[model samples]
Target: MQTVNLGILAHVDAGKTSLTERLLHSTGVIDQLGSVDAGTTQTDTGEIERRRGITIRSAVTSFALRDRQVNLLDTPGHSDFVAEVERALGVLDAAILVLSAVEGVQPHSRRIMRILRSLRLPTLIFVNKIDRVGARTDELVADVRRLLTPAVAPLGTVHAPGTSGAAFRLYDPRSGGDANRLAEALAEHDDRLLAALVDDLPPDPSHLDEALRAQATAGQVHPLLFGSALSGAGVAELLDSIAALLPTSPSAEPEPRARVFAVERDAAGERVAYLRGYGGQFRTRQRVVAYRREPDGRFTATRGRITRLDLVGAAVDQAGPPGRAHGPTALTAGHIARVTGLTGVRLGDQLGSPAGLDGRSYFPAPTLELVVRPRDPARTLALHAALLDIADADPFLRTRVAPDGGTSVLLYGEVQREVLTATLAEVYGIETECGPGRLVHVERPTGVGAALEIIGHGFFGTVGFRVEPGTGVDYRLDVELGSLPLSFHKAIEAATRAALDQGRHGWPVTDIRVTLTHSGYWSPITTAGHFRDLAPYVLMQALAEAGTRVFEPCRRFEAEVPTDRLGPVTSYLVRLGARIDGTDQIASGWRIGGLLPVRVEPEAQRRLPDLSSGEALWSSAPGGDRPMSGDPPSRPRTDGNPFDRTEYLRFLAQPRNRS
Candidate 1:
């Protein structure tokens, strides 16, 4: 059987969990449906998720449709858990975007749509909650077309009963007008279908299905459907559509390659690495080589064994409870499974033969930092150990121990902080108090700068560097392959990364490019270690001469407030340095959206409710870094010239005094 890896994504309260339950229950994978509100959903197995009624982690479950095995990854919809959503994207073959019928296209939904487009994932939009009052399928479809992409083609619609919410009919696409329209839309993109349509021949169901699959796989078309997962309406067709329209993974390879997307410890305290096998086969106790990219742009390979294999959605015996281990000994390609005893396995690690599968390209940076204090100061080391475990599972949560023996955790937002606090107290039995939150800052080069340095203190090495601002959120190092010896190139790149970790302002640097313009060393005295140690000094000197600018993180937010309070709210936001881009009048009020400093977001959240009498709704997400207003902050330049041997020696003698 072929395998399909599908991700179900949406904004919070969009009924994504309910839809997952309906799909599982309709396929006969489970005897009874689990409710998200009741905290009984299969994917939401975490206690914190159940208590908060929100998914904090991405969970996986699988079921079979026809001859295909479909793996469903239910991702968290909350903005705070976007890092979790990002991790799942690297492994997904396709995605299902859920939109609420009543609410229409939300802020986060639009954000997810952009990411899906960037990833080039074929997507299907499911308009859920058709059973509720004021559920206008037509308006919601129009909203999606207007706000999102115009390439969306509706597969079917939901017809609601007059009196009852549960009784509804999902018109078959074969008999509806949409079927013809869908065929036309698919024909516009598929040459074969277009030729047949132009020949005045009626569309064949199989041909149309094939065309839809082809167009969707290429991300040329997105099919939309209407349903209510709560009422079990339109669900059967949804499953059938997934089985027929989605593309299946290619055949397994003779030598297996797999990518690890998530890593965590199970209830038994055993480490589990969740992976999707792109090629080859993996067996229990199989020997595999894990390959990871180092800072110097090289692959580091480590040997490990898969001690156990747990296939998702394996069948349960009649006499056993549901979800009991079926004990699958091996997993073939195009399959998702959990394996144990991979000690060095990390997120984005590739296992087996490294012929395919790229490393993780996206890593969400934590926007908020919290100072954590343990109730018992004596147990500080234990708290740090516990935090390391959590950090290992969720790389977004970066933990650090301060020089003063205090601990801090970098997180996404307030919701993540709450989840962390609860987890620390309940799971690890570590009582803690969190301090005020602060926004993370980054530094970038303001303009082009260059520096040349010659080692004088028995180093016997010379290095030259040029610095400039980068375009994206990446620290780029450019050097010709044969510019220098391979060993020197490696050492220079690694040292450059270490130097970039801390800017002169004591914050990490981002979006900057450094080039090793010239380099030389004496064969007798110069070594890779010497180059590595001296590279930082050269890079820092170049950066200081170029001058660096500090940029605080910012987020764009939209809020719906009463028209009467719009003037004051707008004025207040403007006073806080917000740039209002647009405003639209809604039924109840005005919707305003713009960019603002994240540092002031909490204050705005607190004041907006009171200003609007608790009648306003708002949402925000990371919008990248922006330079601070007024005079751009700059780091102190080095007083002595790097080319002057005497001045350079004096500067190195008292680096702290020179700056």
Candidate 2:
């Protein structure tokens, strides 16, 4: 009768989808589980996802465990697909962070955890691949403590293979070896349970489970479960844990307000938004409010209503509440009710005033970016609209139309760029030519740049900035100006956001703060866009004279070989210009860490197959900038001449060799 929205997360190729299949199969959600290699997994639904054998989009499925309904969101593990993961987290009450028992914590895993911690979501760890050689649960737990989280504690054991071909009892917590650990860990979190244990009183397992679930939801402790999802050894126990420990969706909270996590257009040409309900129950034909565009650009608010609720095949309703109304469920991830009987509801629009309690406002700014151009100039406008639809569906995507008329969409990694390109052609009838992917960077001036007084079309004011590196990784903007009204000051804050949304590279800027030391407003006729245009120009002028630098992404690489391939690994690093930071000699091979430019990461992807002989783990991050040599940092580069949009398009159209 209750629902748990749980997202299964892991680093790419760490067997997340495999575990998902096993969960579906073992729980009887499906008669037979499909494999990733075979491309029949339910969660890998997109065309690109099937071909790539990776989850490019998030998929939702539901099953029953001990009378509770579990709605599982399987997200893409690659960094490029982090946008999907971010959206999934927004709707999820808890997470099951899957880690490779053989390899331990990875970069993408750490990134996912970073977001989980940022959102303050309760978490559980699933150490999978227990059947593989060198998959030591104890060592992996230690690694998780050292690298991921110290709060992670094991739940139970899964049997590994013995001398016989058949796997014996892997490891079960109830088998005395670690059966008492779950009880001890659960008791430590609850004072009453701890007292019961000390007084030699028999404690109820269900009561202890509820206490553990509360502790996990509060971010106090993250329980760990071990399994080999591919071998289906410990999957049943993992499903049981989900039923016992994960929190459930509220029955009747408030008005039906939902965060649209994903946007998908089905074969029927209807938009399907993956919705995470916050307060009220959303039913068919219920109207809601949507904020379509920013205030600066023809700001508009409209209304839309739900048309259909999607579910996963016949197995969906079996997990529903007793005597509940029966409905057809979309095979999409999460609770997605279609927007039908709508006139104006736009993407990223909140249905009602959001509740202030425990709600987060923003997602992580994108760390990667690409300049996209339509192969045909005639399709430019069409492509731009398509991108907006996509971005509306996925709030994590930040886009801005440059002054030159080129549109740049920020993505998290290479896979996203690929998916976008493929999707544009398939869904929108547009073939887009993409420039080389670049690490999205923010520029902060180091000194006082020029101050200019704006006396152009319906705007007037002098904006000054004594720019410098902000605390940690931010840009400090100090402004001095004439007197302005309090309402005008608020307008300046909104204008600063508009400026940050579209930086020089068509990417959203971050780590910067602006001071309205001097502020002013024109006649009431002047609108938000007037301030928006003037603000970015003034900020750009200030940044040009002040020094700016580029930031590259860093990677933590894990490689396993026959010990003979160590030299080859070094050779690969040298050729790729990656600097070695640390190395650990493992029992079978070695693990290494280094700093690598995110742009050239595709090479690491290709070489890892041969270098490790299919035994390698790779993860990387979008890192901060390093110091520039000699002179002060140069002016940040813009996309192209603002007056000539065609020039940039021409450049993008040319082949790399020709360029």
For each candidate, what is the lDDT? 0.78, 0.63
Runs of candidate 2 exceeding 4 Å displacement: 101-103, 114-120, 131-135, 160-219, 250-256, 291-302, 309-349, 356-364, 400-407, 445-620, 623-659
Which has the greatest lDDT? 1
Error of 2 at 230 (Å): 4.1
TM match of model 2 to true structure: 0.71
- List model 2 lDDT by residue over 327-382, tens digit each: 54322223434444443343445454444223243344575567788889888789
Runs in model 1 lying further than 4 Å from the true structure = 161-164, 172-213, 253-255, 293-300, 314-328, 353-364, 448-496, 514-539, 557-576, 579-594, 600-620, 631-659
CA error at residue 333 for candidate 1, angstroms? 1.7
Residue-level lDDT tens digits of model 1 in 21-88: 99999988788999887999999988989988998888899999999889999999988777778778
- The residue pairs that clash in candidate 1, if any, are 253-280, 256-280
Clashes of each: 2, 17
